[model samples]
Every structure is written in structure tokens, then in C-alpha cells.
Target: MSDLTFENVTVRYGTRRRGLTAVDGADLTVPAGTVVGLVGESGSGKSTLARAAVGLTPVTGGRILLGGDPVHRIGGGGNPRPLQMVFQDPYSSLDPRMTIGDSIAEAVPRRVVRGSVARRAEVTRLLELVHLPTDGADRYPAELSGGQRQRVALARALAGRPEVVIADEITSALDVSIQGTVLNLVQDLRRQIGLSMLFISHNLAVVRYVSDIIAVMYLGRIVEYGSVDEVLGDPQHPYTRELLAAAPRPGGALLAVPDDDPALLAVADTEPADPHHPPPGCRFHPRCPVGPLVHPDRQVCLTSEPSATPHRHRAACHFAATTDSATLP
Candidate 1:
């Protein structure tokens, strides 16, 4: 079993003038054999954090540990087999020129399957493991369907025998029907292989179906973290409430109307008031619907930054300390 832990991980890109903090002091733990969902809107840094976990992106600060051994220590090297990633674009991730068999074979260590015949057999077995036809190995990536390409990507990731697989929006590109099939395959793989997964997606419904625990990220930080039932069924943070409200429900009713006002949307996208540059308090005050009720001292909320604290589950908003009910409407 492999346990993945992120201790105050922070990832920043570019220089100060053009720099952005994609992930901000985030902390999460994925115990072996459980699926943990990282859910958020675009630009929320879910994918950024996923890349960092697999050594694809540099971690600007903090540590990523796998089974008590650090993989992304500031000055240390990474462990290859413990953490692996499946990207969002299956088509682009796989080589267009390379045959699917060759791609999967490349992921296998040369020392383990030295001969061509041995590697081919291992590749054939991997294809079957991922539910692809063994003969599909002869086809190039361009010849496969979108779902098939994704399965090939999964096969490649599995070739290394990783304990932790970070799947970043792996189903987003496929059709709805195909998405369900792919998701089921992932769930089945987890049960059969005892794999720990960090599933990142913007789709709440899909996350609910695939995840045991969910962490909601906003503007590079996690606003709430808890079991899927606790967070999605009964969201605690104001942002989370709004997100649920905006999501489409089963009865064909929209959760909530998205803010269409150009000016407000622009303001929402603008860089938040800096913790150091702002007045005294919460960073979410500007766009927070419940800000007035939650923080009567509006000045403080408009000025100071809030820290993550335990509530019914865990939340980073000031109201988290006082509110007991999970607002689901």
C-alpha cells in the first residue's frame, strides 16, 4: 500500500511581474486503496497540483511524500514507480507515430522485459488488462477511438506498476456515454489492483460517483475537504454551496443562475486583493454571497486572509466556525 501526502505544497509559475500562484499552500492525503477527488473550476490549479505529484511539474515549495518517503523534496530526486499521471488529452499524450504496443512497451523498464518478444507479450497483457483487444496493439493512436486512446494511456501508466495514479480530467474529452464506461473501468481497476487515485475533475456528478473523498479548490486553494457525502451532499463553504447550486440536477433544473454581469465576472476574475496588500481579513469577501452574514465585521473580511480550520468536516471560511448546517439548495 502506498500513502501519498502533500504538506503545504505551493506551486508558482513565471517571474514576479507575470507570475501566478497556481497552487497555494495546499495539503492533502491519499491513503492507499482509496480514491480522492480534487474538484474545482478552471484555473483552480487542480491540474497543476496533479502534475506536480508525478514529477511532471516543478514544485516551487513544500513536499510530496509517497508511503512516508518524500518524492518532491526541495533538493531530492523522485521515486518513479510510486506516483504516475494520466493527462487530460489522451490523443496528444500518446505518440501519433508510435504503435500503441510500442508506447505501452516503452513504459516497461528495459531490465524487467529485456527481449523484444518478452516486451511484446507484456504489452499484449497490459492491453487486455485495460480492456482493449490484444491485437489493438498493432494500431497507431490515431486509429483508436477517444475512449480507446484513453485506455491506452491508462495501460501506459499501469506498465510502471504505480500505486498512485493521478488522473487529470481523463474523461472530459469523451462523449457522455463513453465517459461512463471509462469511469467504470477506472473504478474496476482500482478494486482489482488496489490502486490509490487522485481524480481531478470539474464535474461534480462524476466526482461524486468516483470519489470516496472530495476536496474543493477555488483560486488555487482548497475551501473544503471531506467525504463525498459530507462535502457534496452537504457543502459547508459558501463557494461550495454556490458551486452545487450552479450544477445541473437530475430533474433538469439548474442549480443556480451563473452571474452574467460582465463587470462582476471581470471583477471575480481579477487577482484577489493581496493578503499583504489588502485591509485586514478574508480574501473571499468580494464575491462571497454569504460574506455579510458570515462576517459581520465586513471590514475584516474584506482585509484579512482566512486559515483552514475544522468544522463539520473542514472549511477555510470564517462562517465555518459558526455554521452547523450544510446548505444544499
Candidate 2:
């Protein structure tokens, strides 16, 4: 496995003149054999970015590099591809008409699939790796429970022998009772196979449990990227603070959203600006807790975009350097 890098990637919908920019100049990485978690609210462009990496959605600009080469160069007909993705809805990801074994066999490497005996053995091995019963291969997707079907999905993905797997909310649709089982399997697979992954989820707790690094996305940009402790324990962005504080926990305080703070109020009380016409300067300024709209004016947020530092633990905010966790919301 090699490092996965996104350099100034952008995904746009509609025409060039009137388009919705789902991802805007986003830069990120998934180090070899490491899991990077991308967390953001709905419509924050997490999935769009994931799709771009796997060549599902066309990139409007910039590049998706696997190791040092362009990602698209290696994936084609009858090729041993290195990138794979597992979607959110297990019910819809699999084929109801195809038997589980056949579906899994389709993704098996060509050399192994050339023989019936080898194909069967490979299917059995993958099923067992994901903790599914070997007998499951003979059944259709309809015969399995949601959790069981998800395990099958994972097995199918593994059959391709991918180096990097993008899990897009893979556990969000499962029952809470079985969510842990899937999550545990993912961890075990990574530990056993040393897979590099880009794990996407809106659930903060889930992300923290499975990720080596955490990246926070807003609207169409990454506002903060850091280790779990740096982003969650000592957040350097106000939006990051609001996100951590808002997550439900017993006896924990919610963000102190003052009455006079329009930016913060706008996030809770109104719809965000349309993606086709995002607010200039800072796309997040309309809802920023410490933008120029607040008491002490930081007018730059309304006039120019803030750039992220080229460091491991950095944030894209003018006040990021001075944002003290001691006064957290």
C-alpha cells in the first residue's frame, strides 16, 4: 500500500457558469496502512470527495494520486486494481439476484478465479476473514440480515485485494446492536492486512474509535486536520469546538451560543448559503463563532479566505494560532 493524496481536488455539478462546487480545492492524505477519518455535517462534500478518489465522480480540477501516479491510470477492464470503496447502504450495495459466492467470485483476482476450486476457496477465505459463515456464499443477499449482508459487502471488497479502501458511512445504516461487530471487523482487517483507508462518518465517537487522524470538513473545505487528540482534545477552530460540544454526552455542556452571536445563531437557526453561490471570503464566516460579525471584528474573514498551514496539525483559520482551548464553547 502507498500513500493516497488529494491535491487541490474540486468536484462541481451543473455547468461551469452555474455549478455547485461540492468540494473546493481540498487537500488531504491517507498514509500507507493508516486510517484517516473525515467527519462533517450532511452536504459537507465528504462522499463527493470519496467518490472522486475511486473515479466514481469526475474531478473538476486538481488530482487524486495513489502513491506518486494518477489514480485513474491503474483502474480499467480486467486489471488488478488497488483502490476499492464500500458504500453506505448495505441493502442497496449488493445484487439481490446473484448468489453471494458468485458476487464475491466476480471480484476475485483473475488467476484465482480461473479455476472453480480456487475461486471457491478464495470466497471461503474472504467470508471467514469478515467473520461470516462459509455457508453464506450459497445464499442470496436477500437471505442475509443487514449486518450479515454488510459483512458480505466487506468480503466482496477484499476479494479485489485493494490497497486502499474508502468506507463511506459503512456502519451508519446498521442497527446499533450490530454496529460494533462491523466496526470491530474493520479494525481487525486493517491490523491483519495493513490496509490504508479513508473512513468517512458524521459520528464523532465512531471516527475517534477507528481513526489515526481526524479531518473536519465544512461546506466544501477542510477547516482542521490533526491527530485525534489535537482536533478533539485541543481544537484550534471555533467550528471544531462547536462540533465537539454539540455531540451528545451525559452531563456535558453544549456550546455556549451567546444571543448576540449572529454567526453561531445562523448555523442553528437558518439554512446555509447555497453551494452554487457560496459566501465570498470565508464560506464559513456566516456561521463562524469568531468571525468579523462578532464583537471584536476580525474583518479579514469577510474579505479574504484563510489558508491552511502545511503541517501535520494545522487549521485553515485566521485565528487558529490564537484559539485557546481554555475558553472553549
Candidate 3:
């Protein structure tokens, strides 16, 4: 099984004396052959979590396991490198000097890179796997469009035959039309290969389209986690409701939340907690409309961090059971 599990993972940048904690005590898992979409704001640590999964970032506390083997600690060599990441900026990730074929070949394991003929054959196969023309392999990063570059990036990641793919907003840079095509390709690839994926994006609509499960992150924590329909259709956390309200709807370019809505206004005006020095207790409490403002029972949100209490789904909120997306102002 290619299950990816993060047990209370925390990622900090710089020295502990004066560093920023980007991710804090995050417990998540991407089960084998499933897509878990992690959605949040720009600084919500979604990308950081994805990076930690592939060993790109240091895990300051807890463990990151790939199929039950600890992959977090440096030089933990028991596990095969089963994780690969497809970055958001395809152009920046690719080498300007190297041809697409050579770039993909770089991901080929050392044993398989025995000869030029083998490398070329592998590159061709990967290009075909990502739905790219074999002739495209000879081109440079600058020579390709955003969509093509993204496809190339996916091809390179697939070269490793990764058990899990960390897709960090890979389609965000492309145009809307192109985004649909790339999303289709990704879903197709997942179904064809039965690959597990942690799809990270700020776009809830996009996440909803591709995810079997959805995890809603606010600041550095996952405030809500559940099946796509459970979390998106009937979000318990205030943040999740705000996100759904902000997402675009059919025939409506964007969900036009009434300007006078107190909940949406508070959400819009509030800045994400400072990563280096997050708020005490619940990080989202200060801006949470349903906390002290709407319910007296939720006053505890200002002084205590809520655990992931399971009800309809797992949500870290004291009054999650009483809260409803439809009732939010």
C-alpha cells in the first residue's frame, strides 16, 4: 500500500529562537489510490505540508510516513523514494538549458539510466504517458506554453513511477480553458495508474472537481476534514463555509455573497494569523464570526484550541455540531 501518513507534523523555518512555524501539529493521511485535496488561503501551509510529504522541507516534530516507514528524519533510508512533487510554477521548476527529454530523464533512477538509448526510450514513454507529443521532448521550457510546461512537469514526476504525487496548484498558472484540460489529464492519469495524490489549491471549485476527500486548512491547521460532499456541501467550520461562499457557481461567475453579510465581511477583512507568532488558543478564533459574536457557548474558542471532534465529520471547533453553513450570516 502507498498510504502517506503525517502524524502531528510540524514544519518550522530558520532557528527555533527566531523562526516561523509554517505548519503546526497537522495530522493527515492520503490513503492509497485516493485523491485528498487540501484547500486553504495563500499562507495556510498547504504547500508546506505537500513539500514535507516529499522531503522538500524539514519536519521539526512528529513523523511523516510513506507506507509505514519514517521518511521525515534525514538519512532514513529504509523507504524507497516513493513520492514526487509537481510544482505550481512549471517554468521555474524546469531548467532553461536542458531539453524536456533530458529533464525528465534526470528523474529516472540511476540503475535505469545505463545508456542513452534506454534514457531516450524512457523519456518517450513518459511523454506519451503525460499526453505530450514525442517531438515535444526536444523543446526547451521557454519554447512551451504554460499548459505544455505543466504537462512536462507531470511527465517528469511520473518518470519516478511515484506511489504518491504531490500536486501543488499545477493548474493554477494556466488559463481557465487549459485548466480544465489539465485537470482532465490528471484525473485520467490517476484512474489509469491508480495513483494516490495530495492535490493542493486555493481554489475550492478546482479542489472539489478533483478530490475524493477535502481538508480545509486555516492558518497552519486543518480546521475541517471529510469526504468532498460532506465538507463542501455542508461545511461545519466557518472558514469552510466562507470558502464555499466565495467559490464560483454555475451561471454565476462568482458567488455574490451579500455585501452586508457579517460573516463574509469579517472573513474578508481579517488577515491570516502571522505564521511566526500565531494567536494564542485557536488561531482562527479572533476572526471567527461564530465564536463569541454569534454564540456564547463558543466563547471557549478564544481560550482553548479545539480538538478534531468527530460528528458528521472531523472538525476542530467547539460548536461545530451546532453550526451550519446555511445559517451563517
Top candidate on TM-score is: 2
Best-to-worst lDDT order: 2, 3, 1
Look at candidate 1 and give me any clashing residue pairs.
Answer: 245-255, 245-256, 280-303, 280-304, 281-303, 281-304, 281-305, 282-304
lDDT of 3 by residue, 1-329 (tens): 46888899899889879988888999888889999999998888999998888877878888888888885442223223488899999779899999999999888875545688998999998898888999888899999988999999998888876788899999888898999988998899887888789999998878988999999887778899999988977788877876776676777765455778776666667776677888877888767767764455766887889999855478998778777666432
Q: Report lDDT (CA) for all predictions.
A: 0.80, 0.86, 0.83
Residue 246 CA error for candidate 1 (Å)? 0.8
* Candidate 1 per-residue C-alpha lDDT over 1-329 given as tens digits, one digit per residue, 9 for 90 to 100: 77889888999888867788888888888888999999988877899999888888899998899877886442222223667789999889999999999899888866566799998999998988889999778899889999999999999998877778899999999999899988998888988888789999999999999999999887777889899998877777777776786688888786543478342364456554453233345555666655653345555566557777755478888666554343345
Best candidate according to lDDT: 2
Q: Once model 1 is optimally superposed onto the true structure by TM-score, how far is the C-alpha of residue 260 displaced, in angstroms?
A: 16
Model 3 TM-score (2 dp): 0.91
TM-score of each: 0.87, 0.94, 0.91
Winner on lDDT between 1 and 2 is 2
Clashing pairs in 2: none
The per-prediction CA RMSD against the true structure, in angstroms, equals 4.1, 2.1, 2.8
Q: What is the lDDT of residue 275 in candidate 3?
A: 76
What's the alpha carbon RMSD for model 1?
4.1
